[model samples]
Target: MGKLSFNRLKRYVNPEVFDFDTTEEIPPLEGIIGQDRAKKAMEFGIKIKQKGYNIFITGITGTGKTSFASSYIKKIARTEERPNDWVYVYNFEKPAQPIAIELPAGMGKQFKKDMEDFVEQLQRDIPKAFESDSYDMQKSEIIKKYQEKKSELMEELNTLAKSFGFVLKDTRTGIISIPVIEGRQISQEEFQQLDEETRKEIEKRAAEFEVKALQIWKEIQSIDKQARDEIKNLDNNIGLFAVGHLIEDLKGRYKVNESVLKYLESVKKDILENIGKRVNKLEEKVLEYFKRDIYLVDVEGERVGVVNGLAVINLGDYEFGKPSRITVTTYPGEEGVVNIERESKMSGRIHDKGVMILTGYLGSKFAKDFPLTLSARVVFEQSYEGVEGDSASSTELYALLSSLAEVSIKQGIAVTGSVNQFGEVQPVGGVTHKIEGFYKVCKEKGLTGEQGVIIPHQNVNNLVLTEEVIEAVKGGLFHIYSVKTIEEGIEILTGKSFEEIYDKVYRKLKYYYGLLSNKKEDKGDK
Candidate 1:
């Protein structure tokens, strides 16, 4: 077969032909670039807003799946009137089960702030109102009235004791009375001198005084109850004065949402109940960091056993495209293919499978009759995280084949696509983001029109690129080459026929096998 023309092999993109200074000149893309099909499905998902219609955005990660869905939902969310505010509140009936109060669109923030302001105002106002002289004076009047009633009860007890012919006296221990001769207490000796009838009469009178003392204590307890009830009433009146209008104003703001209104009412009561208790600690808010791109496009020269591979990486709460160099080295051994990532336990099952398939492709092409005697090791450079997917399979195979054929791969071109055992290029996810990623790296390194990406032809359908990429492609400052088979990719990379390169690889494998055979024969002789 003829070699792929140099023109068809590398597409050119001139980023400067556009009338813009930098990418900042282009407006930010509104919706997903190449997913018109997903748009319809996503629109349906966003519009329904019903239960059980939840959209599961499943594609490969870093295909802009999460970002696209979020932006699209937000775009559709702006126009339609949906009350989507929610607040977690203490449920009085079930304190452990908090209630989420839903309010109007954009009203959750307002409600939160309003509630905070109300609490802060109460915090400042309630203490001051209780501390005021007027409140203290009213509280003292209640105490004074209680004390007057207590004094009257004590006076009644004294009068009752006098009627019993004993003088009553007040002491810290309790009320007491003594037998008196006229206005004075009788001496102990004189009391004994009295006849038995007189002593018995005195003891009975003392018993009557004790009963009167118990009645006075009961009356004092009644006054204490009245005083406590009166103070509580005063507190309620002051609390209403300080906080009632504040709550009413909040109610008016959230009148559109009955759920929010109900929540606010409950909150008002809770605030009153929890007054004087310091507020609970505020919850911590998470702040997201901006992650910039970290790959550089090599737009000049050529290197053997090196091919650019695209991958997805997650940083904090966001995902982005990362381009890594996959390198391969081959030797004559029975180990077949040694995957460094697999040995280090940094590759996923799918990635391990891809590496295994690389050995299969080599076996089919180079050693059909006898065992494949070559061993190869493949590694993704600077990769520490667990790598998955067969997306980089084709890229890695290119690097291996280049090493075997001793042909240099063009450094300017980055590549992505999966490969089957038949060496057929398969479509991968994030085709668009992968393109943009290499494009940015190339642009940052100083765009060379010769730089481009080789992608699977089947993935062309999934391409939805940004305006800058389109402009660069149109202007011939950048390029995107779509290939169908590994043979076709090989022809483009080496600028030679697929048969010519494979023949070289085949000969090299045979030469190694021939040496192994000779060494075995010499050993038998020895």
Candidate 2:
């Protein structure tokens, strides 16, 4: 099995077969370098608009799955029409079921303000209508008519009482009939002095007069009730006049919106039913939840111990990727590598393991000359949410290395990938998303052709970029580089070869080792 015939093993083609002198002289292949099947599948999924024809992007973490999905969506969203704003209003008929109304963009806020203004105007004008001179005059007229009617009823009762030898009198106890003898009212003691037969006759006549007076009193009570009803009707009519014009104005404003017209009608009816009630003002203001901030964008200058690390922020229904500054600080010590995120309990176990791998990488690369005698603290600056992946392992390493070597990495570029102890850059998920995210930031800050992203070489096939990014790349406004090793990434970041950086880092570690050794010697001597 190990041996092969000369004809089979030594098959060779003529040099004349190729037209180009060298590979560099030939034009590069078009489109992506690999994964033809993936690219085609993505294109098909993105172009199809039918429901249930969704594209399921599956890959290990850091493969750029979310990056691809979000980039395409955002690109398409830019060209689409703005969505309608939805609002819920109180349903007077079915209070438990609030009605949902859809309004054109920005119209929702206008509708809300208009309703508030209507209520305020009603509060001001309704009270004025009730307190006006015309309303008071009308009210006084109704009271005057009721008083005249009561006077007439009282006169009729007095005449009836006189015929019965008892005159109707007005007193503190109310209208009463008193006994009268010889055309003059008599005291209770004189009335009692009369004989039993005379007293009986007087009592019978007074009882008869009381029956007639009771009928007149009932009539007077009915008139009082009628007057009250008239005054109430006047108040209702005045209230309606004060608020009807306001409701009509609001209806005119939302003339074409059937839902708004219906809601306003309900509101008007409710207001008139309970005229003097005050409506509470809105307590919360409309806040924009999805907005861009330049804080996470990359700066224009290079700095030591700092590298732009990419990350994905998922806020369900609105997920996005952005860049975070990963910073490292190194000093002479035996503590190896200290992850500030882990120390503060803001790092997941995977991230802690990634940091531990940094120690392994440092020892493997530079420990032959001296023990890895350095204290390195790594952190993602301006980050509050806990970091949870090994995706930024390469980014953290670059920052640590830059800190150790006193080298500055370019701020215009971002990086994502996990690294092994051998310093090989390994693939991480969301590569497309991370790259696109950084591209967006650089674009906002203004692309300078020098801005780009360095990703793991193994993740090259994960790219399915938006048209905007593709155009930017075609115009040389941005770039993307796939790296196989930490050295390759560092060279791109610092604009220096891997050997030069290694020399600088090794010398610093050697210096640290010597300084610590000298201090120990001095202590032992003392």
Task: Quote each prediction's TM-score.
Answer: 0.45, 0.48
Task: Give a tens-digit lDDT track for model 1, residues 9-80.
Answer: 887988778888888878766555577788688887677757887777666655676777778768776787
Candidate 2 lDDT over 282-331, as tens digits, reads: 00000011124425445578999999998864321233467788999999
TM-score of candidate 2 to 2 decimals: 0.48
Residue pair clashes in candidate 1: 12-478, 13-476, 13-477, 13-478, 14-476, 14-477, 14-478, 34-464
Where does the lowest 10-residue lDDT sum fall in candidate 1? 281-290
- The C-alpha local distance difference test score for the whole of candidate 2 amounts to 0.78
TM-score of 1: 0.45
- Model 1: CA > 4 A from native: 1-297, 315-317
Q: What is the C-alpha lDDT of each candidate?
A: 0.74, 0.78
In angstroms, give how far residue 182 of model 2 lies from its true place.
Answer: 99
